[model samples]
Target: MTQSQHMQIQKTVFIITYGRSGSTLLQNMLNALPGYVLRGENANLLAPLVRSWQGLRRSEQAATMRARGTPSGPHQPWFGYEAIDADQLGQDLADVFLRQVLRPEADTRAVGFKEIRWHETPALFAPMLEFLQRYMPEAHFIFNTRAHEEVCRSGWWKTMDRRVVLDQLESAEQLYQDWQAAHPQRCLALHYNDYAQSPEAWQPLFEFLGEPYDAELVEAVLGRKLMHMKWQKPANRP
Candidate 1:
């Protein structure tokens, strides 16, 4: 497409946080803007490599690494210090589906993703994060958080948000926290309780996006008038 006929420059806001940490709520909230789309938590790509990363833990005390040269593998990692294979590169199929189904018009609005298994191995997945950073240069990110206790409680519910909740199968939270602290301005810290209970505190979300908040925009993106879609009552609610 020509520059004049271009869609809104895409801005990816990575919602890197503990799952069930209110990403859906945030996704719903942000997509309300006229030129924004939310690609809910689709980081399944990192599933294969996390195990090997554990072997390298003791070597680097460095914070986060940067992707200096072009990653020479299928993965085409945006930026980071990881041994990636070019064969590892694959487009987020979700992006293709979105462009085709949800955003056919390709509105001038930017799109973003809010998905993670934060309690999982974040350092191992750094390459993917780097790749995204390259693809979505306009991307800013939101790292949503909740007290570990609250996450546990909510995670225990019947319709547990598996994405937000840390499973017995995954790595601990300290690693996630450390990886996060490694990258500063690129992210914002948002708490689930704060976002759920007091929406006003999230004004910074709008500010970071360089847009004004629209009450209507928030409602539509959030699927309107519902606080926490009662998913089979979160596993075991009375």
Candidate 2:
């Protein structure tokens, strides 16, 4: 797309939230957007000093850790495409992510990172919002959610580890409440259950991203049927 055309699309969506919240399903849906590039869990900036950034959202997490005088927690990994260099990651994440990887995956006007972590807590991710506004100045964010009990259950099944499961449950709700209060307009909150329950649930998100809901696209990306269901790796659940 040309510069004028790119300006018209005017959206780069970041899926910011915890695991086991149906983010993958959302990622799949976003990936299918006409010409948009979607890179899932590609945030590597949460670490001490990795290069390619996880994106503006992870940049916020990095700022949070600095303020707290604490190191990045273990569960919060520095995720990204292995092709990226640790040093040049952050400042250029969006550029590289768009040009090298995501663009090739889907041909679209907008592109984004789908990886997220502990920044789920608004307080935790406070640093991120400001960073994102400055970094990919054109980017937008999505604060995704699911029922607490269901999140816990799904997290547990996905993460056999007791500690990870516990953390997700404790953090998920707070993250939802926190990000919403702090960053309202930029952060669009939605439940994973709705994605499974009805096509209408995604209309707002589609509108937010400046894309129309392609019944064919949604169905093709989210196979089987939309239902109150989920999936996760054993490590992801608590």
Candidate 3:
């Protein structure tokens, strides 16, 4: 579709969580909905774009101060920096993401990806989310979480220091909670343990998205596991 058509995309959904948190399950469920195309992880690719936009914004501010109404010229080192429109640049980046990365089809109503790397940079988490909300069209965030103890014992996390893993998981959960508390209308928080086996448990999630809850679909989704890996023991364990 054309860029203008892509810009017409009215709804977007994002699953924000750490790895091994049953996010793939959520992704699959959301994709099952008609006209919904929730993709898998992109390694938090948008984070760097957000960072670049932020850096450019800072440079623009600094240039405004240093130039003091002087016209920027090619002869100067920071020439043309003051002319940059950081907001437009940010919007263009978001457009590229929607058209190229998400690549929603003609029938797609909602498009997004489930990313596990948001917690990797605690300092940038809020900024990155803010950038998305500002640029992406009608963005909605789904914060997925598993129990900290369960997460620490799952997959590769089992090989890491339990205390460290738990701390990271808790910290990420706190960030999700804070964001959701601040934007209740645009956010939904889901716990894997709470809804992993119960279709009724997912009613609120469906309601939040304004999608009809399909019990049969939910049951079918829960019947199979996505990205399930064999348990890995810590290297030091006997």
Candidate 4:
């Protein structure tokens, strides 16, 4: 098959969430699928790429303004900027990310990674997500969340202020809800509290991705613990 055809058939899924949201477990489950390659965190590298793409788009707008009044000259500040194709640059940047960062093998059918730092800047979340959808091939997003109280008590979160962490978690989940409401077909919101113990809970996720749900595979994936701390139910009466 041709390269273009290969790319067209390949799917991409991103696990978007904050830290200690059981994303590593989700990543492991996805990687277990046939011909799938879901990677771990990359310290949120795509954010900077999105920023650079936005900067290029702004330059392209400036170039358009410069074209209306003056004749083109090599010495001009925005002279060659007119030739810059922001859309093409966006695509090129996305391709570089796919080829270099999330390097898929020859037989790979789907590829993506889980990232926890997306909630760091609430304002940039939408733009970053939109950019990915615009440039990536058949991109789908899975917004993973967890119980705020449990999350704030896990890992490094114990070192931070409780109210501040809760606020961030709430803000991030709200962004997920807003985006999912706007584009239901492309987004899936999964809560750790709902699926941490049961492999059957992930059936809807496989259905959303148009993948066959294998119970045994799911069971095996769930059997292995990927996180440093296992999720424990709070002792408070239900």
Overall lDDT per candidate, in order of appearance:
0.54, 0.60, 0.84, 0.82
Ranking by TM-score: 3, 4, 2, 1
lDDT tens per residue, model 3, 1-238: 6866685677899999987888878898898888899988886788889898888877756666456887677888867677778899999998888888999988888899998889888878988888889998899999999888888778888778998888888888889998888888899889999898888999988998889889998998888766545644322333
* Candidate 1 accuracy as TM-score: 0.60
Total colliding residue pairs, candidate 3: 0
Best by lDDT: 3
Instruction: After superposing candidate 1 on the true structure, give the runs of residues whose Cα lies further than 4 Å from its correct spot.
Output: 1-7, 46-105, 155-173, 215-223, 232-238
Pairwise lDDT winner, candidates 1 and 2: 2
lDDT for predicted candidate 1 compared with the true structure = 0.54
Per the 3 Å backbone cut-off, how many clashing residue pairs does candidate 1 have? Answer: 28
lDDT of 4 by residue, 1-238 (tens): 3466347437899999888888888998899998888887887888888887788777756667566865558877666666667799889888888888888877788888998888776767888898889998899999998888888888677678999889888888888889899989899888888788888899989998999899999889888866556543322212
Task: Find the 10 residues in a row with the least total lDDT in model 4.
Answer: 229-238
Which runs of model 2 end up more than 4 angstroms from their true locations? Answer: 1-9, 43-106, 120-124, 155-167, 224-238
Kindly list the per-residue Cα lDDT of model 1 for residues 9-109, writing each as its tens digit: 55656677654566778877776677666776555433443333333332242122323334344564533444432223333333443354334234656
* Candidate 1 global Cα RMSD: 8.9
State the lDDT at 228 in candidate 1. Answer: 53
